[model samples]
Target: MNLFVVKLSLCFLLFSKITFGQETLEYKLNIGDNLIITQVATQEIVQNMNGSKHEMLNNLECDFNLIVTAKTDSSYVINFSFKRLKIKTMSNIYGELMNVDTSTELKEGNFEAKMFAGLTNSVLKMEMLKTGKIVKITGTEAMIKKMVNKTGIEDEFTKELMFEAIKKEYGNESLSRSFEQMTYCYPEKKVSVGDQWTNNFSGNLIAKNTWTLKEINKSIILSGKSNISMNSQEESYVMKLKGTQETEIIANKKSGFPELITVTSNTQGTSITDQMGKLEIPTTIKSKTIYKTKKYVQ
Candidate 1:
């Protein structure tokens, strides 16, 4: 059922006609709105170390609830919670193979074995401006501890470090990108039905985006391109990384909330370290991510 919706969205994007309204429109969120978002992804990576090849395949799904909890003069306080998560990973290294699968599902009798453990229970309270920018994220150390303990992690230091890492990086890379893709929909000013606007977020990771309003269909379309490049050299080793991504988003015209988002990315990197200094390892990664809003209120 969800897959069918995704395909229909693609067809709509390709065949939808454009219309222009006489007046400018405001596409902003209101108080008391709730958005139920789901993310599904698949990825593959290949690494070449000297003459040996290693490959990994990953599949992941996550569910989130975004609720508007409060309103201010220029911004809104939103509560975001991770409701469920499932992940599967398989790898082949030099002819040896490994696989891992985990899900945070609650069962009648098997609670301990089915929990996602460290992530499905965490919540991030965010302050978002009317223009769709996230200005703050409230911390939740206690929540992280609950997840770590539920997952059977015994080390206190490891749990503490895990919480700190999530606070700094906002969960895994894929999760962070999911929120980033939604926040990128904010336009600076009012726009007509056919007007196009550009928004960008720049830092260690950079993104350039363009958004168009489809007035007749009452949908907003967004397209984006992003890249990252890093290089480091020391007396003992050298490393280099490069990656690029493209994204498409379809959003609700009245509320500026994303309905469907698709992202495709590729990364390639090289690394050499320590006594392995003479050996050069090259890695290539390709990924596809899709986020769909299952239930949304405008």
Candidate 2:
């Protein structure tokens, strides 16, 4: 009888240990929370034109601050503001090198006349879920229009191009899609460490994302793989892009907010255009982007 009692006690302890070890973590939003995120990226692009190769190196940096103003049972209303944007590009075309920087003031050429000087300090409002899904983005179009008007671009052609590009990039549909990709792709149900889920995105490009909860130490780590098929047509060109990307996210386990995120992607594409009369140029692009975040006030 004593032996049977000992065996039963051992079984209870084992069951309790297993249950405690597999406890799930739940994430919810809180008002008055602020997170500042900074992103930096560098890209190497190679294009073949008329049996010759041209290469460009591009660098980009941006900063955003997210402030939660209100929260419901299932969602949060957040205000996102951009503090800075900087882009620098270097290209060697036909043995001549040229550089363009958006943060610098240009004195001559159409670039100077149409430069986006007021792109910084833009703000957008968002309705988002605690699971990192964005339901809607507001005030983006108005902000873009304001920035364009502030440029005071003199040339009509350049002004039109700039306006169109900014609108396409920050407009509601595009911004929503972009924000979706920024998530770690959480599942609908509560998940424990080592859980996995798949996220799909459809837009000008279609990408299949597979994300896994990799680790749970003091912080949580989420890793992902994305397969991309991109196609887009503008007035000047039609581009088809195929690529693969790998992503990693490190989050504060208590708050469920990301502290750092990294993404690396490699793509190859063909651009068909009339720049040289129905020309088809093959291109390759590789980029690595890192985002770091910290707590902020206001």
Candidate 3:
């Protein structure tokens, strides 16, 4: 009887150890690793402008690749390039505003197509820590130059203007902050299942996020909630919004690369525009985004 009780206690202890083990969730990437990532986002925007309701629907699909170029003891150098981009937008006020596909032949004099075509063949260099912190990103200036040149504008003044305009959205700082949302999800120390951590993102959109490790199996399941604020400015308009977002991620166990991610958010605020004598319009936006990643090693 005593031997049977001792064996039962040993089994319970082993089960407890397996269920409560701590894990270091850092990227374990190797050189020559390639990751193909696809992102799809859909947004619905509603605005009350001059006592009239206006609605717009926008869908964006993008494909990009990341290659591990060099690895240090603590960091990795990666090359990132866009493979394709597609956008479709519809507005109740303007009907179909844009429909562009970079994978297909670009139509002559199509401004949207010409603008997005610049993203192809341009590579950006990124330095990231094993802990998933993006240290620095380079090559945005060259990318902006390529994009402006692809527009085929003749006048230098016009090109300069276009360069500045594109820089607002695709600048080095902007890209770094935008990509950090994907990479900056790891804890500084090891954690076990049910453990939670916090991270923050700053850019045009700011988010204070809380991440929880929900499950640890063949793949890790993580869930996140964020309080988001948006403050963006353009030549003609300034937008301020506040909202919350929920995110779910399923990641590869070995490499810590996310296999799938989904995010949903809703924001409400006002857009102040200078186009017509400084009007402040009430606006709301609901968005859903999904990311899928595939890995290849050569």
Each prediction's Cα lDDT score? 0.67, 0.76, 0.90
Error of 2 at 269 (Å): 2.4
Better of 1 and 3 by lDDT: 3
Candidate with top TM-score is 3
Candidate 3: deviation at residue 43, Å?
A: 0.8
Q: Is 1 or 2 the stronger prediction by lDDT?
A: 2
TM-score for each candidate, following the candidate numbering: 0.72, 0.84, 0.92
RMSDs, each prediction? 11.2, 3.7, 3.6
- Candidate 2's C-alpha runs over 4 A off are 1-27, 94-115, 154-162, 296-298
lDDT of 3 at 125: 97
Model 1 alpha-carbon miss at residue 230, Å: 7.0
Model 3: CA > 4 A from native: 1-20
Error of 1 at 72 (Å): 2.9
| Candidate 3's TM-score | 0.92
lDDT string for model 2 (1-298, tens) is 6999999999999988767666344345578888888889999989898778889888878777888989887778988877766666777864424444445665465342233445556678888876777888898767776667766767878767777887787787788777777753667765567778887877775789888888888988889999998788888888888999999988877777777889899999888887867677898889999989866443
Model 2 accuracy (lDDT, Cα)? 0.76
**In model 1, which residue pairs have backbone atoms overlapping below 3 Å?**
104-116
